[model samples]
Target: MINSNIGWEISKNEFYSENAFSKIFDAVVHRTIINVMAIYKKHIRQIRHFIVCSMGILLLASSCSILPFGEVLFSNSESVSTQPTGTIFYDDFSSTTSGWDRSETDLGGADYMDGSYHILIDEKNTDYFSTLYRNYSDIGLQVDARRIDGPYDNNFGLICRYQDEKNFYAGMISSDGYFGIFKIENGEYKILGHDTMVFSELISAGDTGNRIKLDCYQDFLFLYVNDSLLDVQQDKTFGSGDVGLIAGSFEVSGVHIMFDNFYLTDITQTMNQEKQQ
Candidate 1:
């Protein structure tokens, strides 16, 4: 539900608990992956041999699924809405030496292309993301993103508090207008706000550009689409980690996305500014 004070409040009672979400996600996703892999093996058995290659290893390890974190690890006694200030990191992807991963494989690729960071996935039920590898905590991240060439049934957005492929928080919106805040803790995926992705009219449909913003401050996570708050939840499994962009294909393969004008700011600075004011 939309809150005047906060964008959207996710009630733990109304949504799937940690164990329940994990069990269901594990069962459903394991079966789906097995089925997809069977089809993959049938069509392209040779791809399995590529795992020894570096790019193959990279993509396989980078692949992530939409998941969630269980029960709150800790609770913040104080809560405050922050106004971002003081840029911490900014990348326009105009240069290839900006420390983003560049890898290409038959499944997909991620690299700096034509002044933007690009990610493409040619495999079903898989996600590939590229991180800046910078450590951070309490960051406000924003980026301009759009599907370049892919199915409308895809997932792409920003990621924060990213410990690794196995642990991170993703604020995601599909091309078809679904949005959710998900996290993977210790290789177990769970959706923080809802049992499944929730549709939002604020998300731009099709290949149109959307300004996606995610605020990872303390235990609170807020996601905004086109400056409209889309999802809000609280979780403290990960306090700090890397930040990056992610794109994933569902049942349909070929999910390609490009991100540009990415910037991250320190939320603590904003909070201090508020206190002074």
Candidate 2:
């Protein structure tokens, strides 16, 4: 009996040891699997990060290639000088009597009055006015005008770097409809783009007047109306020259107009330097 009991006890001890060894082996395998999964998850995250960064870089490079550098156009390096080099191409009726010349077209009943200018348009009379400024670059041109008489289709705007009456860059707003940037290529003013608000309306002479601002840089042009940005364009055709104003035709009767606050500058270098600071 004693021998049998001792044998039974030894057998139990051996079975328990084998079970403990099996459990330990399974635990080690499970820990190894967990460690491997963690490594795989870390690798996946790294790969995703790399892909996203690559895409961002490519997108940025593409954008840079398409759009002109803002710094080059609106740089702070250029300085605004008090001494004006560019002439005030024209004004309705100025107190200084500087570089403006007054001339009349076949259009009758056109005259200057109340510190403003007026032009009459008819079948026989198609009134037109023009002026020229010399030796100016990089300037902002502004004019305030209102239609006091005539149909809604009366037309007026500023012409910059004008090679002639028909060959130049014209920023015009029509009382009839449409305001846009235009270029006179072969004696015809080609409409580049038109503002939706102005385009949808049927503007006529003696309609509402608006403030127009034109900024010309090296290869860039911007137009603003009523202190708001209306349009921007890139043209290397005419960079620096004279500026002028136009009023006439395309409408029955005529319209009265006024202009003021004419300014010009060559602060291209000064504007660029200021940007860095």
| Clashes per candidate (backbone, < 3 Å) | 5, 29
Give per-residue CA lDDT, model 1, range 145-242, as digits (tens).
Answer: 88877799788888899875557898988899988788766444467856577778888899787889999998999999888988789998999998
> After TM-score superposition, what is the CA distance of residue 212 in candidate 2 from its true location, in Å?
0.6
User: TM-scores of all models?
Assistant: 0.71, 0.56
Per-residue error (Å), model 1, residue 180: 0.6
Displacement of residue 230 (Cα, Å) in model 2 is 0.5
Pairs that collide, model 1: 67-189, 67-190, 68-189, 68-190, 68-191
lDDT of each: 0.65, 0.44
lDDT of 2 by residue, 1-277 (tens): 0111111111231111111222111111111100000001101210000000111112211210121111221112222223333434335353424444343322322333334444334321132444445645676676665555556555567767766443567676766554667665433334454312245333323445566767777777787777677778888877666676655444255454444444554546545666788
TM-score winner: 1
